[model samples]
Target: MSLVNAANRFLPSDTPAAFVADAQRVAVRGERVITLSMRHAGARQVALRYELVGAADAPVVFVAGGISAHRHLAANADFPEKGWVDDLVGEGRALDPANRRLLSFDFLGADGKLDAPIDTADQADAIAVLLDLLGIEQLHGFVGYSYGALVGLQFAIRHAARLHRLVAVSGAHRAHPYAAAWRALQRRAVALGQLQCAEDHGLALARQFAMLSYRTPEEFGERFDAAPEVVNGRVRVAAEDYLDAAGAQYVSRTPVDAYLRLSESIDLHRVVPSAVAVPTVVVAVEGDRLVPLADLVSLVEGLGPRGSLRVLRSPYGHDAFLKETDRIDAILATALRTTGETA
Candidate 1:
């Protein structure tokens, strides 16, 4: 069934005719918002906004990134802005839109107004509802990075029959305690900033701290080993500028509430690897601080014979999935090919 027809079945009879017609109009590449009943108690219902790209009849592939990522997976005439992961989803890329339909969406707490924590399972259920609305019975593959990876694992466990393959990168079955502690600090910073009416300052500080966790000391040492310089009568370290820029950029686009909620969500994430029956490929970075290599190793082992691990040595730390494009592309190509299809 087409998305319009499927939506008509779920939408109330009193739903406006124009709203239903709008759904039909943007069925392919434009953004579509659907109201879904959530699985958790914090919020029972949510407005999920998603976008579909590529051939209308092609096999569906769900792609997601970190908390900040949105529905735009690739650049097109409709969306001129560069995609968050353009390196992995373009012509002849691993998730090429030529033969595979790409689906992506914003997280529930994206707007930062969430009052309660949302589990990874909640995100998985949201994706399941999206598939149903789009008339997609099963996904060809799910490619997730960071927080998205956690959601993919949950999806594979909760809706095992809804997907054929799972590719989880830079995320494990659960957040490591050390990683959760770092996130707690970030949340505390945001909270303190809110209390002082310095929400933006707190958010920037939180993001600056987050950047440190996403990368490594080795990388910082290599890139910012320059001698401290005095500017405006104050000594400034080389790394301070980079961290400041990252923090400022984050503050410009991310709301304080959203940052706190999502940061807490990441720390609260947990899943049972044994419950995930789908064929899985887990990717780990050599020096990742957030998701320790041991955690990922344990996750693959828990999956038994259905799981495999690929480790990449990189100085980029946890952000290797984003910075090491060529290597990630190669891994994705191999993982996505297991379905006996090419894109």
Candidate 2:
């Protein structure tokens, strides 16, 4: 038997949500893969690919991450050994699937749903659509990391009643100008690179710059700052090889053309923190170069009393949420549940 069942028992048998289209089997994950098809105002027919695991009756929790994230979120199904948010969410870790209904959805441009970038608002709409399909009146919690954090905050503003708790990691109400400037150059690399019809070189070059911002100077100083290797007539270092590998890997798995579009989406995303009312935890990393600590200070203030600001010191920069599992897990064990609920 499943951990929990008969989730439908909580909803009215004749609820209007019953009008939702039946989910069709799309592909294989661990146990379930379904298509949540809906009409996009501008894009015509659109389907959001998703996967679900854990107790049927447990409060549903949605997980959203970077642009490359997929709906396949099972921990043991080998959904990318190094998935960006994989470390923080799993059966034995924070946001454990054993006790919660974990819902992972593809971003708007994913699965060929749309060819270009859509703002975090577009992604938030997708979540609302999925909740309607599942007949979930309210999510136990919504966890968003990096790019997904923007979507989470936007969802709180647009669909406050649909979520009980909000976890925004490395997100701010608006994109920092310094961060936007860096991404602008990265997007230019993608637009200018001519290595293939796909602009493969552009992504590689952009990733080189992204790597610096994703990590902290302390990490580089201790790990690969001085290691050098002969490349052509000159010499290179571990940092160069690392960036090259990261860019190559990213291009191999991600849509080359989608890179700049999504990067721009991050820049264009903005929201008013005071408008969000759901209990929220905004996670900040002291070393995050992309979304600086200064930005988080303003965000916490804007959220006022409803938002809780958590600051962590990590060597991974903005990427700490992916690496600092123990600290994140402890924090989430409290944030995922309400004042009266047990984690």
lDDT, each prediction: 0.80, 0.73
Model 2: weakest 10-residue lDDT segment is: 1-10
lDDT of 2 by residue, 219-253 (tens): 99988867587878788777887788888877776
Q: TM-score for each prediction?
A: 0.89, 0.84
lDDT of 2: 0.73
lDDT score, candidate 2, position 194: 56
TM-score of 2: 0.84
Superposed Cα deviation of residue 306, candidate 2 (Å): 0.6
Highest lDDT model number: 1
Specify the poorest-scoring 10-residue window by lDDT in model 1. Answer: 1-10
Native-vs-model 1 lDDT? 0.80
